[model samples]
Target chain A: MLEARDLACLRGERVVFAGLSFRLEPGGALLLVGANGAGKSTLLRLLAGLLRPEAGALLWDGADALADRAAHAARIRYLSHQDALKPALTARENLHFFAQLWGGEVAAALDALDLLPLAELPARVLSSGQKRRLALARLGLSDPARRAPLWLLDEPTVGLDAASVGKLGALLARHRAAGGMVLAATHLPLPMPGAGELRL
Target chain B: MALLARELRLALRHPADTLAAVLFFVLVAALFPFGVGPAPETLARLAPGALLAAALLAALLPLDRLFGADAEDGTLDQLLLSGLAPPAVALAKAAAHWLTTGLPLLLATPVAAAMLNLPVEAWGAAMAALGLAAGFLSLLGTAGAALTLGARRGGVLLPLLVLPLAIPAVIFGAAGIEAAASGLEARPYLLLLAALLAAALPLAPLAAGAALRVE
Candidate 1:
């Protein structure tokens, strides 16, 4: 389980959100919804242990998340707004590089994302939607079945088409049904059923 | 092992980059004789400095991509998220940079030496000095690459940041060669290069790791 208690996040001098608290149990899907400057990404970064909270604490299970960062990272995957694909490398090369880092199967993940045809093409030649899908494929492959239990996504569906968005919704639903947790920050209404919404 | 393999793979894929640096080293070494009038005594006297400078410039050419691409592509975040510590990652990056850039420059040094009219007897010592100096420069370059990450005009900024730091390596490298030519011991100059590498090996990575955390 993941829980944030009295979490206050400050971006520069402006307070993004203060005294914000939420808990996500196993098999829970919490949708983070807010305005343009609602600090949704900041919140997700904090949960991922990428940024420190200005006030309050984030706990995973019974331990402080920040205190055991490596342990936290081993079980959590955070996909940010930037997909972070290297344009000089091919889609398959990128997946292979990341798979080596996270220790997973690259071919299976590429097949799952329907990217085998474009796998040999350089990322620079990939369309924006295709690039996003490739990035998602990397994440799916890297997320170890036993280790990755929590996923934090920031605007994952921004450039995605309707079909890709629907595919994402189904993927999230399946992940949740398997006792994993997802905290997605999206402006659009999610298509998944039984997803809890938190508007910032 | 994995990081080294990745660096080698990246370098191999871009054969033009490695070839260009080697070509630059050879071309730059050849230019000195034309500029200074091809008198053997004068060429031999100026050989050490000229060869060292060419080697430094050639090694520095491809360093901009050392961490720049990974940082931009989000591979840096994944590296940070890996179980390895930031310092370990920095060390691995420095090693990779040396393997790709410095090693090639070291291999091309013999050709540059011949072009500069260096004495045949001094070849071995010159190569050894350059090997040590290149290692130090690679570490320093990694710090420069890290500092310039995400900055506007980073390509221009990297050389500015690294050139000054490279001065020590240049000095030691040239001095060691001159000492060898004069029949004097080159140990003192070699020791200075070794000292620089020792200090930079630990400090460069810490600076790089901190730079990665910068917003």
Candidate 2:
């Protein structure tokens, strides 16, 4: 459902990755692997429509994603290292805000991640690990009008503990079960079975 | 609609951030009397201009933070990708800023002016002018804030970028009040300030949204 042809990305004056091409069908996952500063985050942002490719085109279902930016934005959820949590808001409020933005079910996302217990606490008081879990819960929300979305995640498991990592795998599995796709850039293996890898 | 609501919720949750700008407005206007001395005539003459300038500067303090906070935490990217038009996001931010900072400054303008021995007759025009001027400052300031997002030393650079653009508001704002104080028709000055607002209402958000794309 997604395709990139000779995608050339640059950082400042340097061309981090060039002549890159990939295609992923619905329910597929692409694991990106490369050395530091090899443009994993850049690749995710490029696909998420946040950054334009220095050269190349991104196609969603045979249509130019760049040309139809709003459609591309609607169909994907890009999660970078930054959690995007408002520090002053409670955990549930933070999730609810994003859920409302994305047109997803707030309660379902919370239930999926077992975050109900910590919902009332302000995000500033949450530990890094809990914060990551909260972010993961945000990623779990689904728009019922559409099917589950395409995910462009940058090191999503960085602050997750083993249990949270396992929960993440389960979440991915559920998303895939519902015919969603993921393109995750990670240093550590995501334990996503049947996933294909692309080294930058 | 949702973006505006979310901004209001966040602002309500963190009232102190908005309060700081309002307090800055009060403090800056308060200090003008002390600096200019106890002469009521001199203070009255300075009140309209000083209050308008104070409100403009105070608005600047919170204006930069409108987008800066979200940009830092990656919320701006998410907002962009939330399928809402980028221009609408800029509009929501500009509106929230007015609600929090401009509205408070307008409400306090009477008390603030009174402290400087402002005549009761001029309060209506002064408040009306300050209200409209504050709205214009917010729209212009937000465009600057969005333009400077992620730039080095953006806070220091913001005023230099926006204040020049807002000079019309400052001039018309004080002029309207002064004209009214003399029992003259203030419509010409008020009309000019209103024209500024009407022009900026559509253009500023578009400029700020375009700036977001470049950033």
Candidate 3:
């Protein structure tokens, strides 16, 4: 389980959000909704241990996760606006490189996102939606030992088509069913059951 | 180790970026004769300074792209969070930068040295100094590149930040070559270059890695 307490974020000189607190249990989903610049992304980054909050503690089952970032990062996948891909390499190569780095199941990641056909295509030629899916494919790269990993996704549905969106919803459902937890920031409504909803 | 291989692979995909730095190094060295009015006596006299300064400038040319490309594309952040030590990533990047840019400069130096009328005896010393200077510059440059990773006008800011740090290497390199030209021992200056390399090897990566961690 992941937990945030009395969280606060300051971007530049402005306070984006403050006094935010939440808990995510096994098989749970937390949906964050906000207008543009409402600090949804900021909060997710904090949860992913990407951004340090001005005031708060991120606890993993009562212990501070911040104190051990490498171990924490190994358990979570943070998907943001950028896909972290090389345009010159094909999709498979990109995924393969990440798997080598992160210890993921590459073939299943592609299958989960239905990206096998586009696997050999260079990322430069991929459409925006395809690129987004490719990024989503990373979530599938989790190791078999950790079938129920945490996902920190920011606007993950931005350019996804309807069919891809369904695939995403299904992926989430399956993941949550297996005791995985998700903390997502999105404007699009998703079919997530029994999810904790928060508006920043 | 994996990160270093990945960096090399990415660099391999963009051969043009690596070649551009080498071409710039050669072209700039080639122009020294015309700019300084090609008299062999004067060229030999000016060769040490010319070679060192040109190599310094050429090394600076690629520093901007060192972190800019990865930062823009978001791979830098992923690398930082990839469970490898941040310092390890920074060091791997420095290794790749040195291999692609610095090695080429070393290879081109012999021809440039000949063209500039450097004494035959000084050629070996010059190459040694330059080889050390290349490693030193790559080490120092990676820190500057990491410091300016996501800033606006990073290209313009890089040289201003790095050149001051490079003066020691420049001095030792040029002075060493000049010493060899006069039949003097260049060992002292070469030792200083090695010391600089030693100091920079451990520290540069730590500094660059810290800069990369700034969120």
Candidate 3's residue-wise lDDT over B1-215, tens digit each? 87777778888988987788878877877898898898999999999888888887887887898888887777876776677888888899889888888888888888889889999999999989988998998998999999987788888898899889889998999999999999999999999999999999999999998888874
- Displacement of the residue A166 alpha carbon in candidate 1, Å: 3.6
What Cα-based lDDT does every candidate model obtain? 0.82, 0.87, 0.86
Q: Write the per-residue lDDT of candidate 2 for residues A92-140, one digit (tens) a residue.
A: 8898877776657877787777778899999999998888788889887
Angstrom error at residue B99, model 3: 0.8
Which tens-of-lDDT digit does each residue in A48-161 have in candidate 3? 777888988888999998888888877788887788888998899889888887777777889898999999999999999999999889888766775437888888898888
Candidate 1, residues B1-215, lDDT tens digits: the string is 67667777777877888899889989999999899999988999999989888888888888788887877776787777766677677788889877777778788888888888899878877888888887887888888888898789888999899889889888998999999988888889999889999999899988887786553
- TM-scores, in order shown? 0.89, 0.97, 0.95
Question: Candidate 1 residues A111-162, lDDT tens each?
Answer: 7667888989988999999898888776566545554888888888888888
Over 4 Å off, model 1: A142-145, B151-161, B184-188
DockQ of each: 0.51, 0.74, 0.67
TM-score of chain B of each: 0.95, 0.97, 0.96
What's the candidate order when arranged by decreasing DockQ?
2, 3, 1
> What lDDT tens digits, residue by residue, belong to model 2 across residues B64-124?
7889999889888888887888889999999999898899889888878888888888899
Q: Which of the two, 1 or 2, has more DockQ?
A: 2
Shift of residue A126 alpha carbon in model 3, Å:
0.8
In Å, residue B110's CA in model 2 sits off its true spot by 1.8
Candidate 1 vs candidate 3, TM-score winner: 3
